[model samples]
Target: MVRIKFFLFSILFLCSSEILAQTENIKGKIIASGDLVGIHIINKTAGKFTITNDFGEFEIPAKLNDTILVSGVEYVPKEIIVDDISMQAKQLVINLEVNLNVLDEVVVGKILTGDLMTDIENSEAKREMNFYDLGIPGYTGPRKTQSERRLYEAQSGGGLVPLNPLINWITGRTKRLKEQIEREEIGIAINEAKAKYAKVIFEDEPFSETLQNEYFYFCGDDPSFKTLSDVGNELVMLQFLKEKLEAFKIHLEKK
Candidate 1:
């Protein structure tokens, strides 16, 4: 009889304790700009793991003292503890840092088969040889009025235009053009090169500078290292550019 009573008391105590434990829902947003993003979430007590959605939002059921960790590609991982004792639920906004050192490096171009021009013509799986050079923003074409026409001719051969002068005209800017070829052919070379080394490094100021360089490239202007030697003050039309970079990163990763 004593054993049965003790067992019943023990069960009742456990059930009551469980009911008394604090439980709360955690909600948060993860905003990752400027790079391909991957995320992982961990529940401290449960030792279970999950990931953020495409928009980088996460929700998990947690106890008052439980910890939640968030991580993404090219963005720093963050750990947050649940403290909803006084509050019912919690909301958090996480901003990840960018990785700059890796961004500064130049990755070599992927090789191609056809003749130099033919190779350039059929480079990307999407066959976006010309599209890649389209200026950034709403502008998606050649810097020169004749650039598009020449590209068309090169592709069709029927509009056979002289190649020597065209090559000469675009020569000094080979590095910039090459970067486009890689983007069109495979994807953003930089993102692919450092898939695992994902972290944001540049602060606001430096980030602005880097973006300005991207803008220059977007418009088909090769703002070489020398050209940017003393350049200051970066102008970024953030509204569209932000979306463009994120979309572009995902596109490359998919390829």
Candidate 2:
């Protein structure tokens, strides 16, 4: 029995070590002007991802031949294939090209007058043709909020182009947008938990408003809080909060 246990431990250790050795973090920077923060960096081959900091720097694990794709809202998507040299150096510097909107020559039309009344009377203000005009069915889902829309814009769009990038990158706008959305979710979860468990949980250990706020913030700080809150299951959230309460009580006792 002892021999079997030892052998099993050895196997586990070897597997752990192998996983640890499989990848090393490759630091990289996104070279661009404007908001470089929150650019998405994905390792296509390794299935890893990270975001650029305010300085347009990011790190993601990769080995040789692993593809890194970088995308931005106003930049063209570029792919980097990890080479032996880059792997050895464990760093990358990437340049980005702006995807500028090149407008076609505008057709000469009636110029607008300075007077609003004159412009309204003489000029046409017809709306542009849209999907509805073409009789095409469009998205009927709920409209996305500002943060959601910004997140979508950051992660998507570079127009039709070659996307052989070993990895895909997103603009920095995504990072900030996600945080905003996350805060909203956490706020909702905290409010719901407070309403549901208020007196019941604290009856055994009464806490002042300050302590209560701290306790809830403590719960919010847990990484798993976002997952639980997103799930939005009453029973699951309740159990998770109860577990957090015990942990919080223990933490307070230590202090």
Candidate 3:
């Protein structure tokens, strides 16, 4: 009886540890103009999610290096990592760039009267210059921040991260900051991947939302996963997903 009771206690302790791991809450605010309410804030690593109130402020459970995804319809999606500084501070502040759709500038090739009928008339048809005409491939990928580009190059094994010799022993500060940025990039990339590949990848074996969230967290833990995601190479990511799917299945079996 004593042995069985000790075993149960150990199980409870382990469970408690995991619960605590995801409960280190971080207070934050969205530093963007316009509507901030209903902005979704998700702790992707922990599978925890929340939304901002009317004040553009949110509190979500997160730990150091955990990825936090911030998304809204009106603003460009952003990811933040819970680095040591953010964890230690009272709150984290994120500045999000609002997504803008600017139409191409139009100039009248002919004089036009301020009349509705004339405006409704079809304009001249001119072939716009494009990459096809130039024989150059077009890039339609998401824009990368400076840190993100560095991280991508690092992952590709050709990046040289230069640091001042004086600050060489950075008390793990540099590493922690880098991790925060890395996690942010990874979270955004993973979000895009889930949207694009979720249906196709899980056709054989569908998973519930909770299970899927856990599976994504497992994938983000992989070192090379972020690199492939950054490149946005469809074939490479598909293969990566297949490999991770098998690994995830094996993990579930072990559990």
Candidate 4:
């Protein structure tokens, strides 16, 4: 009887320990422009998911075979599956590529505009310097108007058919007229990202805070970002796209 009781106690203790053991966690960071921008961790079976802090770090209970979705403003969303590679919960980096053509319009005549610049500036505007503040590479001019000036200056080396001059002769810098094709390409890239993801962050109403906290780091303040504050749900994404395009319009408008 003593032996049987001891055996039963041992079995119960083992069972309890198994039941109380903590689950393993998944950890990782989201990357953009070659730096951590967001954090993503999920344990759907446990009904838990946590976003990292501003520094882009997070840890959450997880297990083998779980799935995690990582996303951010203007980036491609990625789904991660746990395996031997992910089971260790190693620091993971995710890169999101921008979507190029959402509207199916490949027309290259669109021009860059100041309004687009203003809008893009607003998206993550804050009080800190950003990659842009470092100034665009291979382009030089006054700081305030530097980006503005780069918009119109013909390619300095003049090897690739002089994009600015070709655009100048074609579009002639009118508001209604489509401007430079190069500027349009940049505008489309920016607008496409904004149209697809801005609503996911700004107008979703339920998930606005999730977007602001999890994805966008405060870069600096711009009227463009502020313009999105009161935007309605149906139009929020469109507004973001339009604003970005307006910024692109600057390429044709300047000089």
Q: lDDT (CA) for every model shown?
A: 0.44, 0.67, 0.66, 0.45
Candidate 1 on 1-255: residue-level lDDT in tens? 999999999999998666445455667677667443336555545343344666777666556656565544455555676665422536667676654444554546643221222222222212112223555445433354344344444434223686654664467444454444534433232332123112211112233555544433442222331222112111112112333455545654676
Worst 10 residues of 1 by lDDT: 229-238
The clash numbers for all candidates, in the given order, read 12, 8, 0, 18
The TM-score obtained by model 1 is 0.30
For model 2, the superposed segments whose C-alpha errors exceed 4 Å read: 1-143, 162-171
lDDT of 3: 0.66
Model 3 per-residue lDDT tens digits across residues 54-165? 8999887666777776767677667677877886784789898786846765755642221211221221212223355779898766678877665454444222654442
Q: Give per-residue CA lDDT, model 4, range 217-237, as digits (tens).
A: 221123444334322222343
Q: In model 3, how large is the Cα lDDT of residue 232?
A: 40
Best by TM-score: 2
Question: For candidate 3, what's the RMSD?
Answer: 24.5
Residue 52 C-alpha lDDT in model 2: 75
